[model samples]
Target: MFGIDVRTARVVWTAALVLLGLYCIYTMRTTLLVMLFGVFFSYLVYPLFTLAQRACGLRVPRTLVLLVVFAAVASIIGLVGLLFGNQIVAEATNLGQQLPKLLQPGELERRLPLPAPLEPLRVRLGILLQHLLEGGTAQALPVVRGLGTSLFHAAGNLIYVVVVPIFSFLMILEAPWIESFLASLAQRPDGRLWSNVARGLNDVLSQYVRALALLVLATLVSYSVTLGLLGVPFTLLLAGLAAVLEIIPVFGPLIAALTIIAVAVFSGYGHVWWLVLFFAAYRIFQDYILNPWLMSEGVNVPAILVVFGLLAGDELAGVPGIFLSVPVIAALRMFAVQVRLHRAARLNAGGAAQG
Candidate 1:
């Protein structure tokens, strides 16, 4: 047996405990992801609930306001589902049916020009394509099987959904208590520093969420209008995809537009020029107008920093990382600023007294 001193044994035990904790978290990653999303959702919607409280006057309790807020969200979801359900379903089905044709070797090769020197690569690609087409059923069977597996995985998650709202509501309801607890943990007796940090976080988070919502809406509207005007089939589905992709910040909208444009090209749409125009116009609008205005209003995060944060988040945590990274970075920035200012002030006063 290896000889170990008490301190070494304790350190080893602590490291083992830390590793065990990490393993446990990795196992429960999905639930933790959902919970984090739920928390952010609550943060985003808190202002609306507060506004509802004000609109109701002091007569109605805050609990009632939360209920109203929940109902409003649920109603909106239901209304959208009711209004667009058939169109969405039809467009999704149409897109699925057209996907194979769209992916044909001739269609892809037509779209992408290959260099003459890359003939060998092209030949290999052609062989791969032929193999894919010939063994399409074999290749697709696993994917089809995966759909059933995914459905089974998702089907009985009602309890999780129910728990999310409950947790969100509690987080919102206990917001004041949470603040009090954090305040108590502050280094300074006055607690002003922590209070400032808390307020800054709230303000930044609120603005960022609002800006994201507006950007998503703008993207959805612009994409839907353009695709509809171009007579693109599956317009609803593509527009919805654009809206969802809008959540990813810089690269998302471009990907959505390119995907839609590709679909247009493959569908034998006569006015591909119009589709190109739409994408160009939307890109201009987003770059010149919406993004600058929305981001400026949301947080004072530099564009470069936002991109860096996005890359880092994606590297660290994939999609969830991207979603959570922005606000977390902004909050950290605010805290850092507060700390620097406080330290500078204290140092200046001490220097003046010494002089």
Candidate 2:
């Protein structure tokens, strides 16, 4: 189109395809983001599907198998929610009650260790807090009002919980058809290119999901045990928080630890040292042993790259980006590898014929 010959037309078309991809990403950003989450959740629950199929002797219909898995997952979530609903509500209420006091500058400083140099900073913080309580209240009034609005909106998340199962069921049932459709779109449908791409995607996603599941389980067990021993209120809620944060990669565990520490400190726990020790131990264990082992087994994405992806995703798509960035990058990486391999195979075949 830009004064290009027939051969150059192909190059231009490829560029156009790239630009079209970028445009699609821009346009379907939210839908694609939600679908990516669906895919991840699908991957996470896939093992349960496989197990169910095997348990049913693999003769049961795939649809039935999916339904069984979906039911099992729903039951578990419902049961847990029912069982811990009161405790979670109580803990949340207690945390809410303590938040104002906890946010006081001197309160945290008095309970937790602070650096010697930060004493002067603490005084400044007190003054700042005083000013905030006075002049900043009016300025912050909008934020308070916005939070109320957000709370109303957040109540709709139950709809998402209902929607997820439906999405997962459709994806599982039609997964094969979806793959076939994608393959049909490729330039050479029968080429090894698509096979390699599919294999790479499967391997990366499955491994990542498995490793992540194990890490989550480990975090839940570790945190639950520690909190139980330390006699922390809301053990289940805190452990659940740890498990959720464990999805964030390296930084997740640190945030979880800090959150646990903060909650424990504010809850007026008698043995804060035990809480601190619990956090420190888990942090060390996760960094030194758990993460290394899991990353080596799973996606092999570099820590720095992961951090950058998280930051970029958070900026672009908020929490969804943080959760999906690694898997999305892994998928893209798989695609690139397939393309490169296809080109290399063609070049090798050409050289072999000449030789």
Best by lDDT: 1
Lowest lDDT 10-residue stretch of candidate 1 = 106-115
Worst 10 residues of 2 by lDDT: 105-114
Report the C-alpha lDDT of model 2 over 88-183, residue by residue, as the tens digit: 788778777877887676775555544688776766656565565556667878878877786787686557655666676788888789778666
Poorly placed runs, candidate 2 (over 4 Å): 1-17, 102-159, 175-190, 295-298
TM-score of 2: 0.79
Tell me the TM-score of each prediction against the true structure. Answer: 0.75, 0.79
Error of 1 at 201 (Å): 2.9
Alpha carbon lDDT of each predicted model: 0.78, 0.77
Q: Which pairs of residues clash in candidate 1, taking residues 3 or more apart in a chain or in different chains?
A: none
Model 1 stretches with alpha carbons more than 4 Å out: 1-31, 105-156, 179-187, 190-193, 296-308, 352-355
Q: Compute the lDDT for candidate 1.
A: 0.78
Cα TM-score of candidate 1 = 0.75
lDDT of 1 at 280: 85
